[model samples]
Target: MCATLVGGMDRLKREYINAAKANGVELKVFTGKENCISEKMGQTELVIVFTNKVSHAARKEVMHYAKSRNIPVRLVHNCGVSSLRQNLATN
Candidate 1:
């Protein structure tokens, strides 16, 4: 599975990455304004996006990329560790 932290969302990106790794999962954090999401997803089996700003475009881009790749994606709205567990469990 592939995981990328969407946006800077620095507030929680670090913790998210930490938790993901703790579960033996590797992840990439996207801190740029507009990143090459599609390309990033290419190397990943699944794209786990964590963000507070859930815009229509963001939602579309994420869903489109994951769906197109036939890779399952789980959205983490908060930095709560529980969400990470649930997300990783599916993988």
Candidate 2:
């Protein structure tokens, strides 16, 4: 499953989701509000926060929830390798 932070919905059109779809993957967009985001999280396997604008509240809540569920979080800007590098740099 896939859910993006606010402003990441455009990725669905920017070719990433399309590639996933071409590879026969199911991508889901989180359209609900704050409380709804948690509910949506339950149905998803991972949360990809593409936008830096994600609120502090959402980040803390989602990170905690995802951690408890063993769900991985990814921040993909364009490619997977660069994302990994960025994550590693942050670490």
Candidate 3:
């Protein structure tokens, strides 16, 4: 599955990417909210947002775009590798 990960620290982003790789999931991570554009949304099957790390406007925009395109989105408060793993594992 291809997923777009929005908002996370550099270290956490790397960890999430590594974890996703290990799980056979392709992940495209965007550290800044600005990178969560509509163009990128089209390439992903899922959208996971780190709620605490991103701006409200950016989050809203992402949610709106994802919903419009009928893509699934998961929002997590923590931006850790474990959290990402658990979320992906369940869905």
Candidate 4:
């Protein structure tokens, strides 16, 4: 599976990436409000937003892209690695 993660600290990002890799998931992370390309969206299976850290515009864009492609999205307030892992495990 491929996942797009928006926002999180460097340490948390590393941990989250490691966790995803361990679970056989490829993760693409964005820490800023930059727009994602359609080619990238094509490879993404899910979108995870760390609500407290990401900008509203970035979140909206991601949600819009995912919705257009019918990909699943998970919104979590915390940007911790454990929270991300837990959310990802459900889907």
Number of the top candidate by lDDT? Answer: 3
Better of 1 and 3 by lDDT: 3
**How does model 1 score by TM-score?**
0.70
* Candidate 2: stretches off by over 4 Å: 1-17, 31-34, 77-91
- Candidate 3 per-residue lDDT over residues 22-41, each given as its tens digit: 88899988765575466665
* Tens digits of per-residue lDDT for model 4, 1-91: 8988887776576788898998788888887456664345558888888999888787888888888889888999989888888878888
Which residues of candidate 3, in runs, are more than 4 Å off? none
What residue pairs clash in candidate 2, if any at all?
none
> TM-scores across all candidates?
0.70, 0.55, 0.89, 0.86
lDDT of 4: 0.81
Q: Rank the candidates by lDDT, best first.
A: 3, 4, 1, 2
The residue-level lDDT of candidate 1 at 65 comes to 78
The models' CA-based lDDT, in order, is: 0.66, 0.50, 0.84, 0.81
Candidate 1 global CA lDDT score: 0.66
lDDT of 2 at 17: 51
Candidate 3 backbone overlaps, count: 0
Clashes of 2: 0
Candidate 3's displacement at residue 10, Å, is 1.8
Worst 10 residues of 3 by lDDT: 32-41
Off by over 4 Å in 4: 35-42
| lDDT, residue 81, model 1 | 58
Q: What local lDDT score does residue 80 receive in model 2, on the 0 to 100 scale? A: 40
